[model samples]
Target: MERNLMKGNEALAEAAIRAGCKCFFGYPITPQTELSAYMAKRMAKAGGVFLQAESEVAAINMVLGAASAGVRAMTSSSSPGISLKSEGISYIAASDLPCVIINVQRGGPGLGGIQPSQADYLQATKGLGHGDFQVLVYAPSSVQEMINLLTKAFDMADEFRMPAMILADGLLGQMMEPVEFPEAKTHQIPKPWATNGTGMKRKHNIINSLYLTPEELEKTVLDRYKRYEVLENEHTEAETYLTEDAEILVAAYGATARVAKSAVIKAREAGVKAGLIRPITLWPFPKKEIVKASENAKHILVTEMNMGQMVDDVKLAVECRVPVSFFGRTGGMVPKPSEILDKILELGGAE
Candidate 1:
């Protein structure tokens, strides 16, 4: 298939429809508005429902309602709106529903700027809700990957019977590129466990996770952990470049990763054995891969659009055997390749 040019947001919308997402509920937010707009126009043709909920909170709840009916539902919002949706997300997680959410992050700690930022790394990986639940997070660096990730997000949600998120930033959401869809395959159907209501030949089933009993809650938590273990083994994926024979390795994801690639090239030209390890799944954190990369590297440089979020994960993955460092810019400013390279040189690690 020839690659088709698409903006990241549009690509996600198209992928959602193709992946059998029949319900969409969302309110407008910058850097991701195009995603909803595309859905509004295309959903009808695709036999999907695209509803513009009155607010982020409403949008997320609408998704919860639709998902409880066993329909593939979705919603997209930026950081501030995402914060509002978090309350409902807790409910969705508590209910053990299957759905997809997209957070095209922007600068934030508040009504932060609507520009590219990696500040939400911890928020997405941590429990967004009050419970001991997890969100399957896909961190895509390009429009093509953004499209591809949405497809995978649906699959994971059905397989694990949990919510999955495509955690992209404004940069990746707004960028334009050519993307080719995966080879034709029938999108898998959700398990019969998915509720279609119980009035015919089946008994009624309730899908809420709100157990009042402490013993039941403990069992639920342990059961969810077991499912996550399956994900950690089967779904975690990452990309590594030039790691072999490289004494210095750069770690990053999304737009920050694209910037780090340039640094890797410059360091290589300067006779330094510098490489890159780009994580595609932020939740799983690619720990095993980073640990392997650490064994052969002397220094690991973690770069992000925020002060230091993913660096903490890198540090944990590598442990104290190797030195891990960080460089970043926050509040909507993306670091330049040359600037990151300068930091690498200053560390005396870029050769």
Candidate 2:
């Protein structure tokens, strides 16, 4: 297999194309603009459609349209832009449409700087939109994992008939690393519910989210939640490092996980029994893995490039069996490995 050194944003776009993405509709935003640019350059040649819509709202609605037609569609944006696209995201989820969303996150309460931050963990996993709907959220810590997971994001979106998000950060998006593409596998899922066209031979399939009758709407939402339950049970993913005899466990994801892993390794070398648990799926959240990884732990530290968002999840996952603490940075600032190592040492009582 051959490997190419590529920026994370470009690698993600290429991976989506390889995953059979047929339509790309996105507006340019800092940190993630390269992904849309790559899609624009390559999508036409791949017999796919790439359009830069007038706004993030337009872009996401376009994705909804393409998804209704049963094509693999996607859009990319940064943090604020994602907020603009949230309503359409809810529509897609409520309509049971399948599409991928890429969020190369930046700092933010409003139009924050274009530097890496994992502050959007709550938005992606909890409140992507105003509804009782969930999108599959994958957090990639490396450029290579970004490629691998983007492909899986598309597949899983189709499999579960819902939207999926690649929850990446600016550091991962702008970084360069060697990545190998997987052999292209054909997407073979049949979309019999698609509103493509009936050809007058069959009844038209309507793509809609509005249910005027409250009971009908409740039924539809309930059914979607049932699918979500199955997804949670079977699809959660996490990575654990040196956790067997660990007395101190660290939980982090995406770019922060990369830093935390380094810290864990340093803590171990310094004679601390430290471990790291990196959640790959932020929605399902790998709670089971975190629980198991922290079972033998005396202290658990949750770290992120935000104000302790994931710490809540980590605490809930372990059910306060072990004391949970948090370390973080925000507003486009990233946590350093040495800082995390210091926190680990403090938690391990090695300092």
| Best-matching candidate per lDDT | 2
Candidate 2 lDDT by residue in tens digits, 7-65 = 99999999998998999999999999899999999999999999999999999999999
Clashing pairs in 2: none
TM-score of each: 0.97, 0.99
lDDT of 1 by residue, 12-97 (tens): 99999999999999899998999999999999999989999999999999998888888889999998888899988988887788
Q: Candidates' lDDT values, in order?
A: 0.87, 0.93
**What is candidate 1's CA lDDT for residue 135?**
90
Worst-scoring 10-residue span by lDDT in model 2 = 179-188
